[model samples]
Target: MSTIIHASAAPKFPLPFSHAVRAGDLVYVAGQVGVDPQTLEPIGGIKEQTEQCIRNIEVILQEAGLTLDHIVKVTTHLARVEDQPEYNEVYAQMIKQPYPARITVFSGLGPYLIEMEVLAYAPSIRGE
Candidate 1:
């Protein structure tokens, strides 16, 4: 069976989408931007946006009773390829050893400098 997970800390955009959805042991996080959940505005520049995006992902993971350590893969989309190094600096600090498989994609999907999505896997929880 599949379950949908929503993060209370995520901004309510009145959009028809869940923050992340879980199926069995896997969780797929939607694309995350730099917007602050409360304000719904882009956080900062490329670096700050990258940081915020990661932080947002972490929050969603926590809501699912998971952690960054449980993430199996990450897909990043950038507005400009030139910002990769800056994005990497912040990305490296978020995950630890045996890092998750990741791919950096260049696209114009969001208004911020960085956008990210994640996939996580873990044992079933009590209410999951």
Candidate 2:
């Protein structure tokens, strides 16, 4: 059976959706914007927003009893294609070696520069 998950420390979503949903061994995290958890406002520029996006995903993963290492796939949307270089720099630093499969594309994100979503593989890590 699938289970819904929510991260109390993650930013409250403006849209209606759970932070994540776990189906058996996989957890699918909803897309996360580069917004502060407390303020729910978009952070700085591309690099900074990228960092925050990963951080936000981290929180949701943590709630699932998983870590970044558990991520198997990622999908990101960038408001500007030119911001990719800076975004990659931050991503390379935050995400470790043997990185997850990822796809990033330039898309209109309204006021935010970056948004990300992830899928993680965790086999009964929480004894669930």
Candidate 3:
């Protein structure tokens, strides 16, 4: 059975989807943008946006009783290829050693400069 997860620390945009889904030992976090929690507005340049995206993902993980260290995989999308260097810098700083396997793509991402989704795992605690 799977359970939906939502983070109160993140923006509530009245979207139709849950922020993440937990199934057994794994949690699938949906793609997150750089929208500010207070204003619900997309943040500044790539660096700032990338930071916010990670922060948003962190909140989702928190709701699942997990942390960044639990992430096993990641998928990143970049609206502009030119911002790759800045994105990489921010990403590296946010996620520590023994990094999760990741795939990054440069594509049009609407109004956001960067976005990321993650898969994390932890031992099942439903019965305990």
Candidate 4:
């Protein structure tokens, strides 16, 4: 069985997708954009947007009774490759080391400068 996770305190973007889903022992979070929860607008610049993206992911994780510490893998998407360094600056602050396995891709990501999706491990829920 699987469960959909939703965070009431997170930004309510009108989308047909759950914040995260739990299948067996893993929690798979949707791609999180840099939109502010209060304003629902993309934050400015790569650094700020990266921070907001991480914050959004954090909210989803919290709703699942998990945290960044539970994350085992991460995938980041950037609108511009040049901002990779700036993205790293904020990302490094949000996720601790030994960091989760990660991959970064540069692509056109609508109005948002960056986004991220994560996979987290839940050992206690393996049989659920």
Per-residue lDDT of 54-128 in model 4, one digit per residue for the tens? Answer: 999999999989988888899999999899999998988988877888999988888989889999997732123
For candidate 2, lDDT tens digit of each residue in 1-128? Answer: 99999899999867889999999999999999999899989998998899999999999999989998888889999999899999999999999878889999889889999999999999632222
**Candidate 4 runs further than 4 Å off:** 124-128
CA lDDT, every model vs. true structure: 0.85, 0.91, 0.89, 0.88
Reference-based TM-score of each model: 0.91, 0.94, 0.92, 0.93
Measured with C-alpha atoms, the lDDT of residue 97 in candidate 4 is: 77
Best lDDT among the predictions, by candidate number? 2
Kindly list the per-residue Cα lDDT of model 1 for residues 1-128, writing each as its tens digit: 88888899976677898999999889999988988989989987888888888888889999989988888888989999899998888888877767788999899865788788999988732233
Show the colliding residue pairs in model 4: none
Question: Better model by TM-score, 1 or 4?
Answer: 4
Runs with alpha carbons beyond 4 Å of true place in candidate 2: 124-128
- Model 2 pairs in collision: none
Q: Under the 3 Å rule for N, CA and C atoms, how many clashes does model 2 have?
A: 0
Candidate 1: RMSD to truth: 3.9
- Candidate 1 Cα misplacement greater than 4 A, ranges: 124-128
